[model samples]
Target: MKKYLTQFKPFLVFISTFFAAYIIVTLLYKFYLNTFETNDVDGITNVVGKNVEQLMDLFNCDIKIHKSIANSWLEVWYNKKYLVRIVEGCNAVSVIILFVAFVLAFSGKLKTTLLYIVFGILFIYILNVVRIALLVVLLFYFPQYNHFLHGTFFPLIIYGAVFILWIIWVNKFSKYAK
Candidate 1:
């Protein structure tokens, strides 16, 4: 039993850290939701929606972001036509939480781990915002591929990026690398 436990220690640590971080982040998000009066979308979702709106505007696209009829999403209109909805899940907080948990489970030096987590979360956040914006544009022009783009390609992009970052961290920065 001791020998088996020793061999699986890393895996154990990883699973525990992942679950702990996920639960904590989820609880915090719930607390934030309770504390605020976000009618349609939560603050983070609203921010993502506004950022997507601004990005679309930069392309000279007629973009409008408004409160959705469904109380948990933000309605996005392209050229005055409803194109997409930005929901809380689209904000990428959950993704960031997963990323951070994985990184913490494979942590390196204190300073390096902290800085890397910060940068990783920021990168994921920014990438998600861009992903949402581009998704809207693609959906607008290629409505036929909406399901594939949303359900498959776009998620792959973000998760693929996270996977790459994880590989880089484990190989270069993680204490386990040595």
Candidate 2:
């Protein structure tokens, strides 16, 4: 029994840490939503929507983003035409939570781990915002490929980036690497 338990210790530790972090972060996020006055748009969703609008404007795309009439989403318009809806799910906080949990489960030195988590979250957030912005433009130009782009290609890009980042951390910075 002792030998069996010892053999599974590392797996247990990783699963425990990942679940602990994920639950804590998800609970905190839920608390934030329950407590805060999100008005029509939640903070993270609003920020992502605004970032997408700003990026589009930078490219002279003439974008407009405002609260959707359907639900808690931001309706994005390009050249005054409805393009896409930016929902709370598009904000990428959940992705960041997953990324953080994985990193914590595979942690290295304390300071390095902390720094990597912060930067990794930032990178994912920025990439998601950009991804949303570009997706809008792509859908506008190529509405024929809507299902393929939104359902398959874009998800692959975001999750693929996360996977690459995980590979880098596991190989370069994780204690498991040593």
TM-score winner: 2
Candidate 1 residue runs with Cα over 4 Å from true position: none
Per-residue error (Å), model 2, residue 87: 0.7
> What is the alpha-carbon lDDT of model 2 when measured against the actual structure?
0.89
lDDT of each: 0.88, 0.89
Cα lDDT tens digits for candidate 2, 14-84: 99999999999999998877764544678888899888888878888888999976577889888778988
lDDT of 1 by residue, 50-146 (tens): 8888887888988899887747788888888898888788999888888888888888999999999999988998899899988988998999999
Per-candidate TM-score against the hidden true structure: 0.92, 0.94
lDDT of 1: 0.88
> What TM-score does model 1 achieve against the real structure?
0.92
- After superposing candidate 2, which stretches have Cα over 4 Å from the reference? 36-39
